[model samples]
Target: MRAAHIELTPTEDDRRIARYAAAAIALSVVEAAIPMPLPGVKPGLANIITLVVLARYGWRDAVWVSLLRVVAGSLLLGQFLAPGFFLSLAGALASLAALGLAMHLPARWFGPVSQSLVAAFAHIAGQLAVARLWLVPHDGLIAIVPFFALAALLFGLANGLAAAKLLEDAGRTRQ
Candidate 1:
């Protein structure tokens, strides 16, 4: 018996997405190295890439980049299929939903900063919900909301500003 052989051709978009995903994954690794004051309070540097992609490309490409980051980052960090993986998955899904909605807002009014803030809150909310329902299963989980919210605000704003700068630079380079 002979097995079937298949070949897939790569499109320009596929190469672009792969490049973005690689950058995100690299950033995730760097983020993992930073010392965090709290367990789930990394700066989420990779999300800057997501925001940039969202602004420049579109939500669909952004989604692909974001999910690839989560999956590939988890695998790289040796957390695939673990509780942490699920938590990350939930947060990414929630963030993507928020981005999808936020993208529809007026571009002049709600740029990367506002969109990042919205997605950040949604990301933390989704993680908390998963932790409460599955990991802790106690009302005690509520105590961490304020902390996470603060982190979300600070990190979201920072990432958004960075993305905006990158976008600005990219635009300059293109012209």
Candidate 2:
């Protein structure tokens, strides 16, 4: 029996996805290098790319870029098949889902700031839930929820502001 051969054609959309995913993965790697004083207090720099992609493209492309980042970042960081990978995947999925819903809100009222904030909170929620079900499996873990939420809020706000500025800059470049 011969193995089946398949060829895929790359389109402009595929190139766009590659560019966005590269940016996300690069941010993730850079963030990993930063020393965190606490366990769940990451600045979530990679998520800024997600917010920008979601705003510029749509949820579908945003989701693709997010998942690709988790997978590729894990492999690059040598965390593949580790607990960190699972946590990252869970958080990405949750955030993407949040972005899907957030995208429906009035774009005028809810821009990158709102979307980024929502995704950040949702990311923490997913990670906590995963920890509850898998890692610690302790009700006491809930005690740390407030801290993570606060971190998420701060980082999300920062990322959202950065994304907004990037979008603004890109708009200027296009003109």
**Which has the greatest TM-score?**
1
* Candidate 1 similarity to native, TM-score: 0.97
Model 2 alpha-carbon miss at residue 116, Å: 0.5
Q: Give each prediction's root-mean-square deviation over alpha carbons.
A: 1.3, 1.8
Estimated TM-score per prediction?
Answer: 0.97, 0.95
- The lDDT for every candidate, in the order shown, is 0.94, 0.92
The parts of candidate 2 lying over 4 Å away from their true place are 1-6
Model 2 vs. true fold: TM? 0.95
lDDT of 2 by residue, 18-70 (tens): 99999999999999999987785689899999988988898899999999999
User: Could you give candidate 1's per-residue lDDT for residues 68-130 as a string of tens digits?
Assistant: 999999999999999999899999999999999999999877789998899999999999999
